[model samples]
Target chain A: MAERIALIDYGAGNLRSVHNALLAAGAGDVAVTDSADIVRAADRIVLPGVGAFGACMSGLSALPGMIAALDEAVCRKNRPFLGICVGMQLMVDSSEEHGSHKGLGWIDGTVRPLAPSDPQCKVPHMGWNDVIPRGAPPLLEQGEAYFLHGYAVESDDGADILATTDHGGPVAAAIGRETMIGVQFHPEKSQRYGLALLERFLKWRP
Target chain B: MTLRTRIIPCLDVRDGRVVKGINFVDLADAGDPVEQARVYDTAQADELCFLDITASHEGRETMIDIVERAAAVCFMPLTVGGGVGSPDDARKLLLAGADKVAVNSAAVARPELIRDMAQRFGSQCVVGSIDARAKNGGWEIFTHGGRRNTGIDAVAHAELLASLGAGELLVTSMDRDGTKDGYDLDLIRTIADRVTVPVVASGGVGSLDHLVAGVIEGHASAVLAASIFHFGTHSIAEARAKLAENGIPVRRN
Candidate 1:
């Protein structure tokens, strides 16, 4: 039987694009669901988020038992998990956007405003940038990916840093430990590089 | 590598189909926006911009459907604009899979719309569009397809939009629109310098060299053109190559 992937939908933006990208990436059965029960029963989970960190977290939390279900599925069950953009930021311990907001804390870090050392680098880091992998992170490979965000993860454990991208200096592009992986760039918007990443993600065992 | 300068091909949509026009007038049928988007996606164009010129109430639904279809096939970032008047208008496009919503006339009428959109959806999704033309010694904002002069200082308007939390600015020069001359480099540089956010240079791109100049001279983070891509004057690969040859960082396929 094909592995069922649960794409959590909590009224966040880009749910449909992510869903369509997953299907294009060769997933056999992907379920777009808000039900925690469906999430708990899935073989893999993909969290996609857009907009503010606080807003996205609140929206996810607004869905009763969804947080616990994610925790149960990814932490306890050790299922393959992937988070994109704000979804990746949510994996950190907390975020400084719109005041201090607690996150999933799956990874030790804080989501802070992207302050590139060079003032000329610009904020929001809009457009395509290189995803320079640090060592080997499995799902992450060295390629150009589409990035559109003002905030980024500052993982506390340097060992947890899976990939880095340049803005003014080294910025965390992807962070993961064990079966969970998170990317600051949107794979759904990264075209071929993104689709290849998703293809690897679909086959990622750990 | 650093953040590559973006080359976006603008698609003007009317009643769910792509249309090409000069200076936003003299409309002619092009092709399906989804198909054009797929072509750009395959060509590795950095992103795509869709301008919904449909004015009818029912036409709105058709544009939404087109956006949905395009987003399905094209995984690159998509920015949709034209007639976005409210947060709800922006929401519908976002839900339809548009990565960003560009607001021009409505935003000029009510600057607060930019704030509302930036606050509700985050600045990344809110793109402030400034349509300006040379007036006296300075540039002034225009509306209604560069026909109506708002008598607003383009520089101050750009600063205000950026202050209002616009993530990016799409600065288009009415004087150069569809003229096949080139981008208003000074106009683009003025707005790009005033705002910290990325600015997309639009209007009057006739050749790949114009795209290179838009970044080198205009200092824009991205460059947008319709006629150049729609009419097949230059392919995206050739454009990227020219930009790359000119020392501007562009994504190599």
Candidate 2:
């Protein structure tokens, strides 16, 4: 039987595009669901998010038992998980966007506003940038990916830094440990590089 | 390297179909916006913009459908503009699969609209579009496809939009729009230098050099051209090559 991949819907993120990308990447049983039961039962999980960190956090928290189910599925059951853009930022301990807001804290980090030393480095850090892999992180290959964000994660431990992209300096582009991974770039919008990453994530044993 | 300079192909969409007009007349059907978008995606264009040039309110729904269909197949970031007057209008397109919504005359009419949309959807999704024509000393904002002058300074307006929370600015040169002269570099620099957000240069792009100029000379973060890519004047790969030759970092796409 094909693995059931749950694409969590918390009233935030580009749900349709992500779903389509996963299918394009050859996932046969991808479910776009908001139900905790579905997430807990799924063999793999994908958490996608857009917009501000505070709003997305609130949207995800609005759903009862969703976070607890995510915790069980990802932390306890050890299912492979992936997060995109703000979804990746949500894995950090807290975010300074729109005041300090609590995140999933699944990874040891905090989301901070990107203040690139170069005045030329624009905010939102919009457009395609390089993804340089570090320490052979799973599901993260060296390539450029589409990025659209104003804030980025600052991991407490360098071991969790899966990939880094340069704006003014090194910004954490992808982070992970064990079965969980989070990417600052949008796989659905990253074209072939992004689809290839999704394919790797779907086939990844860890 | 920093973020690569983006090359975007603009599709003027009307009633669910892609169309290109000269001076907003003699409309010709280019093809299905979705199909065109797929081609651009395969061509490795960094991003795509769909401007809903539908003149009638009734045609707006069709634009939304087109956007949703395009988003399903194309993986690149999509920015949709035209007839985006309110936050709700932007919201519909965003929910319909647009990554960003560009506001033009509406943002000029009610600057708060930018703030409203940015507050709800985040600044990353709100794009402020300015169509400007060179005036007495500086450029002035023009509306209705550059038919009406708004008597607003282009540079000041760009600053206002950025401060209001527009994630990016799309500035078009009305004077050089169809002349194939090149982008209004001084105009782009004035605004690009004033704002911290990324700026997209639009209007006139005759050759690949214009694209590099938009980034290096105009100080624009992205260059948008319609006829050049749509009419087969240049392929996206050629444009990337040109920018690369000029020492401007561009996505391999």
Candidate 3:
């Protein structure tokens, strides 16, 4: 049977685009839903988010049983999980966007704004940037990916830093622990490189 | 490298088909916006803008299906504009799979709409599109396909939109539009310099050098052109190469 990938759609993210990208990456039977049962039943789970950390976190929390299901599926069951953009930031301790908001606290880190030393490095970091791998994580590759965010995750344990990208300095581009992985860049939007990463992610045994 | 300067292909669509006009008249068929979007996606376009140009004249929501179909096939961030009158309309397009919604003439009519959209959908998803013509010392804001003049200063309007929570600004030069001469560097620089949000320069991109100038000289974070990419004058790969050669940071495959 194909992997039952449950893509958490809690009224956030470019859900349709992510779904399509997954299909292009050769993944099958992907479900974009808010149902906790489907999330718990999935063999692999993906939480894709687009927007502010506080807003995304609230949206996720608004759904009853979703987070607990995710905890069971990802934290307990140790199903292969992926978080993209704000989805990645949600696994952190808290965010300093709009106001200081709490996060999932799964990774023990804070989500803070990217303050680039160069005035030219605009906020929202809106465009394609390099993704350089720092530590080996299953299926993780180094390449450019499309990024559109102002806030980034700062993990407490530096060992969790799987990849880094230069904004002004080394910004956390990808992080992982055990079977879970998160990337600041939108692999779905990175074209061939993105497609390659997604394909690797689909085939990853972790 | 830092974030690369983006090269975007603008598709002005009506009734779900891509169309290009001359001075808002003599419209010609280009292609299906969805098909063109897929082509650009394969070409690795940094982003895409699908602006529905027939909003004020005809009242309909044809872009929902277009957004859904294109988004289903393409993976890049897609911005859908035109006929986004209320937050519900924007929500519909978003639910159908649009990443961002660009508000143009309607925003000019009521600048507060920028704040409203920003509040509803995070400011990052709200793009303020301004059409301007060089007037006097500055530039005059125009709407309705550059047919209506608002008499508002372009720089002031750009700053106002940013303050109102527009995360990005799409600034089009009416005077240089379709002329293929080049971007209005002074106009783009003034608006880009005045506002903190990333500004996308539209209109008058004749060649690859024009795109580079928009980024290096105009300080535009991205350059959007239609006829050049659509008419097969230059591919996106060629554009990226030219930008890289000129010492500007660009995404390379």
Candidate 4:
């Protein structure tokens, strides 16, 4: 049987693009569904979204049995979990976008807006940015990918950070511990460098 | 660390094939959009922008099929433009796998469209595309593939778009377009000073030095060119290497 990859679709954003990207990355049995059983049983789980932190949390909350299912699959079973963009921010404790809103709290951190001191520096840091790898992750061996988020996760425990990218300061780009990984940048949209990372993640035994 | 100067390859698609020219005139056949995208992908171009030049006036929807096919094949982030006049259109393109959507005429006609799209789909996905021509003494906004004049100051409009929730600006000079003389530095500087968003300097990029000048002198976030790349005059790798040598900090292959 082919390895099943469950893509959580809570109607946040970029669900189809993420699904298509996985398919392009050679994922044979990718299913874009919010079913609890399928999510729990899948070999890998991908959470992808492109919206505000508060909005994403609400979407995840609105989903029937989604939080419980994701928690069971990631925290309990410790299956390979990957979060992209706002999905990565959702892994943190809270965000500052639309006032204070609670997140999944999987990682102890807060999502704050990027601050570029130069008056010319734009908000919602979009487009391709260079990823400066701090701790070596097998997936990021290729190079940097595209990032399109306004808020970034500032972890309480800095050791969880896998890579950093500079805009105003060194912002955390990727975070992981054992089987769970969260990336602020969109690996699916990062082009060749991103594809290589996804391939590595798919092939990772752990 | 210094930011890298980006080399972007733009494709003007008419009936699915990539065409090139100055001021959208004397259209020369480039190649198939999918094939051209793949070539740029392999060549290590920083990003790709596909503009459906004739989609809007034709009263047709944005080409989602071509966008999807190109997105599936190309590894880099794709920005799709032309005929995206509303949030729904922007949503459709994003759903079709566009990393960003560039809006020019629509945003000009209705400034609120930028804010609405940004609110719904996040600001990063919204790109404000400006086509400006120097007239009399100041730069004026030109719409409909540089055929119609909007009588809006280019610099002032760029600032307005940024404030209205556009995440980035793709500024193209109609005067310098297709001239291959190099980008209009004055226009780029003017717009760059006005907006905080990343400004992609388009039109009249002839050589690698011109690309470097665009980023350094113009203070632009990226440099976009058409004829230079389409005619096989300069490769992305070579341009990046040259930029890196000049201390511009480009992603090395």
> Which parts of model 3 have CA positions greater than 4 angstroms off?
B21-30, B56-60
Residue B67 shift from truth in candidate 3, angstroms: 1.1
Q: Which lDDT value does model 4 have at A30? A: 92
The 10-residue segment with the lowest total lDDT in model 1 chain B: B21-30
Interface RMSD (Cα, Å) for model 2: 1.0
**lDDT tens digits, residue span A1-206, model 2:** 99999999998888888988999999999989999999999999999998999999999999889999999989998999999999999987899998999999888898999999999999989999999999777888888999999999996667788899999999999988889999999999999999999999999898
TM-scores of all predicted structures: 0.97, 0.97, 0.95, 0.93
Give the per-residue lDDT digits (tens) of candidate 4, residues A49-139.
8877777888889888889989998998888888998888888788998699999888878888888775655566766677877857746
Cα miss at A153, model 2 (Å)? Answer: 0.4
The lDDT per prediction is 0.91, 0.91, 0.84, 0.81
Error of 1 at B225 (Å): 1.1
DockQ of candidate 3 is 0.72
> What is the DockQ ranking, best to worst?
1, 2, 3, 4
Please tell me which model should have the higher DockQ, number 2 or number 3.
2
For residues B1-253, what per-residue lDDT tens digits would candidate 1 score against the true structure?
7999999988888988777623322224336677777778887889999998988989888888988999999999999999999999999999999999999999899999999999899999999999999997999999988999989999999999999989999999999998999999999998888888999999999988899999999999999988877777788788888999999999975
Q: What TM-score would candidate 3 get against the native?
A: 0.95
TM-score of chain B of 4: 0.92
Residue clash pairs of candidate 2: none
- Give candidate 2's error at residue B46 in angstroms: 0.4
